[model samples]
Target: MQTLYLSRLQHYLFCPRQFALIELECAWEENVYTAEGQVMHGKVNSGGHDTRGNIKSVRTLPLGHKSLALEGVADVVEYRTDEHGVQIPYPIEYKRGKPKSHRADEVQLCAQALCLEDMHNCKVTEGALFYGKTRRRHAVTFDEELRALTLEAINDCRYIIESGITPKPIYSTSKCRNCSLKEVCHPKIFNKNAKAWLSNQITANLNEVRQVNNNDD
Candidate 1:
């Protein structure tokens, strides 16, 4: 089985079709939001490690879990010493924007925490998401609810990937408007007229084949 990316959890959560297009079909496009996000992650992963009183920060740590078949590079993982003198792994994800109403970010963070737990063979009770826009850390606990949601997303993505079929687009003004793949997705145009669109595409391909045969003659 291919390793599922932790980052792709957010993609699937936001839109399954988006996840399928990028992961299954290897389709991508960049817009201002994604560009800024890449810039933010670039800076975050620039090996800018530092040490505080009891915390040592590690940048761009590659994490994976064989059992879950999930992997990704975390932006930052802080090793914080507790009163008992044991260090705990705390994941911190960097985002270019503020938090949204959806649980995508939270699920992504939770998946990171789960990977850490699996690799370290210890409990990672919490993690944090640092938004560049807000300049604040939103701490997420690995509670039952969040963990269940994250695992569900992982399973959902696994099924989609294994099927090797790109999901049909379902548009939403709030979510699809700023999507980088909006033009590629044509969510609004295609989903509404799915049958007609498929028929037109098939007809165009048949026409191309007919032209090719004529040229061969």
Candidate 2:
């Protein structure tokens, strides 16, 4: 089993094709969104630790889980004492933008929790997502639904990596317009042309049937 990057789960949720292109085909192009994200994470990834009262923050913490076959560095992990006075791990993921319409961020955070649980041998019940745009933190719980979604995402990524097939580009002005790989993907041309070719083939098949009827007559 190949070790899947914990970050790729977010990519998979955002767009499976994008994940395939980057992971399988080794294709990458930095657009404004990606560049900004990298810069945003740079601050958090600088590697440091801070203590505030009962909470302690650690940065750029390496994380992995053998069972899940996932590995990556967590942006931050806040350790706090629970009611039992036992220290608990809470992962904090930094994002460049605000909350998205998709569960990509949540899934990634949950995977981090899974890794933390495996590493610490303690249940990481919740975590936080800090968005640069909002400058706010959103708490995420490791519920059954999110865990299942994360697991599904892991399987989806593994399947795509093993299959080594790039998905056909989907043209969406809202989505592809800002995509960094739009030029390489060429969704505008490929999707439109593929649809046109399929239409033409159907038309030609119908025309041939009509011509055969006329010849019989």
Candidate 3:
């Protein structure tokens, strides 16, 4: 099995074809949204540490789990003493946009929690996602459902990526508006042209069959 990036799980959840396009086809084009996200990540990726009382924040911490075969860096891992005075790890992800209609962001954060759980051999029950647009931390619970979904996403990503095939793009103005690869993917144009070409081929084949039948008669 190929090692998958934990980050790609969110992309796969968002759109499997988008995940394949980038991970398998090595295609990417940055739009304003993606650019902003990169900028936010850059600040955290530099690596830093801060302490306040019993809570500590570590930036850009490396995380991976051999069982899941996924690897990536968590944007932030906040540590705090629990009721029993034991330090607990809480993974937090930073996003450029607000909460979407999907659970991609939450799945990504949960994947980080899973990694932390694997590395530390402790249960990670929750995490947080901080959105720059909202300037609020959205807490995510690593419940059974979310963990199952994250595992499903990881498996799907590995299957799609290892096959080395990019799936067809489904165009939606609203969805594609913020996609950086919209121009390269050309979802609308590509599907339109494909349909046109298929129609032409069928027409020509019918004509050829008719001519053959007439000649035989």
Candidate 4:
């Protein structure tokens, strides 16, 4: 597999076109929202030491999976020891917004967990998602389902990048309005024909199947 960046998951979650533009097409344009996010990350990336007894907080730790060829820097990792004196590391990702109604944020957090698992050679059972808006941390459990989803997203991203084919835009009025790539993707114009063609194909298939069944009867 080709090397992956943790940031790609964020891009894909926001918009596939955005992901393709940055990762595959090497296109980049910054807006105020992105600028603010970068500034927040910068603050988190700077070194700061904090200790609560045996637990320690490390910021901006480099993480990678050589086998998967994926790498990135984790925002914060809490290190603690178990009863048996074994060290444990948990990753924490900071976001500028509150939780959404989708698995996009979870997918990104799970990716970080996977990275920690690979780098530490240990089971990272849980992590945290800190939302700037809410000023709260949501603990995420890295269960089997979440890990599977993370792996799937990573594979999908790689396939998309290698194919160099941007997925046809999905013209969702709400999504289009919020999407940073709306102008670049032209969702309304580009998706109209594709959506129509798909609907036609589905209708044709249904009719053909119905005819076949009637003839059999």
lDDT tens readout by residue for model 2, 72-190 = 99999999987888899999999997999889999999999999999899998999999998999999999999999999999989888888888777777877888898888888666
List, residue by residue over 1-217, the lDDT tens digit for candidate 1: 8999999999999999999999988999999999999999988898767899999999999999999999999999999999999889999999988998999999999998988888888899999999998999999888999999999999999999999988888889999999999988999776877689788889999999999999999
Q: How well does model 2 score by local distance difference test?
A: 0.91
- Candidate 1 — which residues are off by over 4 angstroms? 196-217
- Give the residue spans of candidate 2 off by over 4 A: 193-217
What TM-score do all the candidates reach, one by one? 0.88, 0.88, 0.87, 0.84
Q: Which residue pairs in candidate 2 have backbone atoms (N, alpha carbon, C) closer than 3 angstroms, thus clashing?
A: none
Q: Write the per-residue lDDT of candidate 4 for residues 1-217, one digit (tens) a residue.
A: 7778887887787677778877876777666667778988988999776889888999988888887788888899999888999779988888887887777878888887777777778898988889889999999998999888888888889889899898777677766776666667777777778778788889999999999999999
Q: Which stretch of 10 consecutive residues in model 1 shows the poorest summed lDDT?
A: 188-197
lDDT of each candidate versus the true structure: 0.92, 0.91, 0.86, 0.82
TM for candidate 4 is 0.84
Per-residue lDDT value at 5 in model 2: 95
- Per-residue CA lDDT of candidate 3, range 1-217, in tens? 6778888888787777788888887888877888899999998778988999999999999999988787999999998888898889999999998898899998899889988989988899989999998999988999999999888888777778767778777777787777887877888766566778789889999999999999999
Residue 177 of model 1, lDDT score = 92
Tell me the lDDT of candidate 3.
0.86
Model 2 weakest 10-residue run by lDDT: 186-195
